[model samples]
Target: MTINETLIEKKFSNDLTEAELLEFKKLYETDDAFKQEVDFLKNVQRVSETEDDALFRNQLATYETEISPKKVFLNSKWIKPFSAIAAIFIITISISLFMNKDINNDSLFSSYFEPSKNVSAPIVRSEKDEHLTNRAFIAYSEADYQQATSLFQKAFEQTGNSELLLYEGNALLAMDKVTEAIEVFKTHLTYSDALTNRTHWYLALAYVKSDQLDKAKQELTIYIDSEEKFKKTEAKSLLKKLK
Candidate 1:
């Protein structure tokens, strides 16, 4: 099956191999045709599920006001029938909520995306061989992402140091190369045990940039639950936005 066709199934099933995942990243970053295909499929799926987004939201608001907050006295005879009716009402509204196209996770991505904080800025690099690393950090701090991305990658290749990898990912992000940043973090997390919570924060932001709502949600879940979560407050706030 074509990647686009597989993407539709994967969206629901949440079962993408690493290579297919990379294809999504590539398409999202580089391919206008593929991007449109994904968007069209998303809209089609949403439209298939919901006729009107505003109406869907309104109905849910109504149901929430009527159903969830009340103390239902189920033991009383009149209340029992009312409860049964309410249950049916809830099931119907729940279906509507899921199917609505306008009820999307991407609406808040822009509002929630601030640059993930620089946690490694305080360290001093002081080696002759580490001149590129120092320059990369300087360029990164100055927001010269083009230079930083190149320098950081060079340092990473020379040393296999996780710090360079992390900073390179950050540079990729500053350059708006988010999918590449995500891949860098994915590899770093898999291979290096050094960068932890902060790396996850960057990964989640990369997912947010890619508009991969579910993937972002997963990483945010890790952040929210982690005691050492570098972006705990941000993750909590972003989760609220996503939901």
Candidate 2:
């Protein structure tokens, strides 16, 4: 059926089947002009359906008496001026109301209007021992591996904390500096106590990155035997993958 006929039938009919609605949706997707005409008809039908009968009858009478072709002010020069005056009055009232709104300077509204401050928590530089560790973590989170490595190096100079060394090693690994990462991890292992299960796993990963499969397997063995069940499980999986 033609688009116009389909739209008229949908508008006047009370009970369109599901199939007819689907067909109308398909037509709307494929034809923009058909969709516009359908939308206009739907809006007209909605206004007629919701209009108060008394108000509509009064409006019809007014239209016949004062707005008919013979009686209407079609050529009056004052019509444009009256419309312009009405528009200006509406705009002025809108601006006045908008400007006179009760602004709460002391409330949360002031926070939105004020410029934001850089109130981020200061970088935790508590001690020489923790300074590099904290800075490395911040740099890693910010995806600044080079800065993290430099900070990690400075931290290691003052306090050779295995954890800080591991951070440096991990940063090197992230930068694809595998040989440097391997050296850092190995240095940590030389001084690290037997309780350092996490370090062993990370060292194993560094070894894998360096293509030292045998060393990676040996480190994974130490990691898998540790009491930390989670790290041991992860190490076992890596060992299986290496094999």
lDDT of 2 by residue, 191-233 (tens): 7554355667777776665557788899889878777564565
Model 1 lowest lDDT segment of ten: 72-81
Error of 1 at 127 (Å): 14
The lowest-lDDT stretch of 10 consecutive residues in candidate 2 is 112-121
- Estimate candidate 2's alpha-carbon lDDT, on a 0 to 1 scale: 0.60
Error (Å) of candidate 2 at residue 161 is 2.4
lDDT of 1: 0.67
TM-scores, all models, native as reference: 0.51, 0.44
Clashes of 2: 0
Best by TM-score: 1
Q: What's the true lDDT of residue 106 in model 1?
A: 43
What's the CA error at residue 106 for candidate 1, in Å? 7.1
* Model 1 quality (TM-score): 0.51
On a 0 to 100 scale, what is the lDDT of residue 222 in model 2?
82
